[model samples]
Target: MARLTAREALSYGMFGNAAMLQNALDGKANISLASRSLPEITRQLRDAIAKRTVSAEGYPEKVGQPAISTELLPWALFEEFESLAVDHTGETVFLPPGAPQNIPRWKNVTFDAKEILELWPIANQQIDAWMNADFANNPLKKRKDRISDCTRAIPCTFATATAAFNRSPSKKRSRGQRATNRP
Candidate 1:
């Protein structure tokens, strides 16, 4: 919900992209967040970005990535901008977003290659369960959601599951969901 409008605030920046990526990796959605209270969470996210302090409703204090990684951010205020990027070798290759080639340089890389390489293994070390025990009573997760299917039998490919997420989500959680779902 905060991401839906973050583009304007973030200025199409490579730094902003890195910031948002870290936010996703570090923060989990509050099961209690919904339309009735979305504005508060959006304010919290915006405030966190602006002030570098967090007080989100469902998270423990200081749980998510609050500081942006300056080294990972493109220098020259420039870096190869891409919708998708991969670390292929010594060079970082990226598919540019409709711009002419103007490679950005990272002047002060504080971390070494070993740290970057280790990140992949760390990310893959263990899979975290999406729906924790708190979601045991959620009608959506229990009956309407397709999430459980991915855990059993054959896994659904991205293409196969793309349509599953294409459906319009409800504007708000009904009273039934709110009374029961807590995390």
Candidate 2:
């Protein structure tokens, strides 16, 4: 099986089919439920629910028996961003409408408006482009291409961080040393 790319992981984590998510979990992909970033999960769930990729019955059966209504989940998730206020009075204070909240701070917490907006459209574009591309006439190839395109477009900060970490040590080596070591 081809290794799941960071972009695919994001898409699967955001709006992947139920079978796809299960497959990802079973395969122990880097972005399994236990290991996936919350933003990625949020994006995946949001996208899936929005696109009807995951139906109410597709939600995992658990003891909590949380109501799994696709219609409500989106609004419930959106409610989290109801206010961006600081309670300076040492008491609970509600933020007024149109408060000038820091957007980056929200991004750090969950899928902020900016990040969601950036990712959602790209996901749609990837799917649409894949449908119209070279794979249009081939069902199997189209599936592969869609997955590839989706995964390629989505950004994975964890992957970027890891790459940076790996490269940091190597960056110290002089160019002459690198050149001399080449085969």
Candidate 3:
């Protein structure tokens, strides 16, 4: 936790992540209060989200023994279901499932995940450079680096993104065509 914002609490951050984090934080838009507590809250929140039941299989023994409860059919018990059920969660937050939408939202569009993986090294280099570069912390961009925030940020380098875009096969398609992907 020290590596993350130097506090026991976690910050989902603002501006870009504000809405999504707001949706995730339990109390609607009152997310700012989450940065003031312990990690146990997060664990409890995850349990609350995935917890289905605490049911007893048998009666307690006669000698002041307690009944042990079992978690029945909770989503976390199954690895595959966890992906479907939980979009995101933490101790202090659980983002509800979002509305499903078309992946490309356009006909004749597709993605090759392998190709993206191949380009990851270049993307990583750009990201490292961006992190090590001065001005990443500035509220305003430096004049020389201000072609656009894309040039100063990770994964949005014009040359690399444009090259990847151009590498993809795009074309005018007939109305009958459908988009597909391998990602």
Candidate 4:
């Protein structure tokens, strides 16, 4: 049995009269009246509010719960029939004999191979800097410092190479082709 303030009671649509509202706030009268009327109301209100709240369930305790823990079948191990039978539009895409009802969507995203090849030297330099920092025990040079240095170095390398990539290749003439002055 809890008594709510007038403001709280008003928020819950308990009473309209100013004097009655004051009495509720003062904890004198309307204590029993409000509680009796709004006993199950708060539960319904909470349920409604909870539906709108964004929630994640991977914290230590929540992760340990059977409801939160999920098992997934690897796409590589999926049989041809199972792949064909999966509902592509639904939330869960894959299901083996006894697999969980829902599985997070796994995407096979790929980077531009040529772009990656171009960045290889930059990656090597960053790795070397990181190793050197670790060996030297440099307190100021953190992982992010190495990244920042690499980012700074990349623009200079990119500027020099920009012209080469941007230049349109000259079209070569075929063996049979010859220059003819025809306008």
Number of the top-ranking candidate, with TM-score as the measure? 2
Worst 10 residues of 1 by lDDT: 119-128
Give TM-scores for every candidate, taking all chains together and pairing residue i with residue i.
0.18, 0.22, 0.19, 0.18
Number of clashes recorded per candidate: 1, 7, 1, 0
lDDT per residue for candidate 1 within 1-183, as digits (tens), equals 232223212211211111332343346523231222323333333333233232111111123544333333332122223231222111222334453455442212222222222221211111122222213334355322444442231123443333333332442245576534443
Q: Which clashing pairs does model 4 show?
A: none
RMSD of each candidate?
Answer: 18.1, 16.6, 19.5, 28.5
- State the C-alpha lDDT per candidate: 0.28, 0.35, 0.30, 0.31
lDDT of 4: 0.31
Question: Which pairs clash in the backbone of model 2?
Answer: 7-151, 8-151, 13-44, 14-43, 14-44, 15-44, 15-48
Clashing pairs in 1: 75-78
lDDT of 4 at 114: 28
- Report the lDDT tens digits of candidate 2 across residue range 48-99: 4345343211122235566253121233323354442212111111345554
* lDDT of the structure predicted as candidate 2: 0.35
lDDT digits (tens) for residues 68-143 of candidate 4: 4423323332332232111211122233345553433322212222222222223333334433444244323333
Q: What stretches of model 2 exceed 4 Å from their correct place?
A: 1-13, 28-122, 132-183
Residue-level lDDT of model 3, residues 93-170, one tens digit each, is 122443333211111111122222222223433433343343334423333343344343333456653343233233
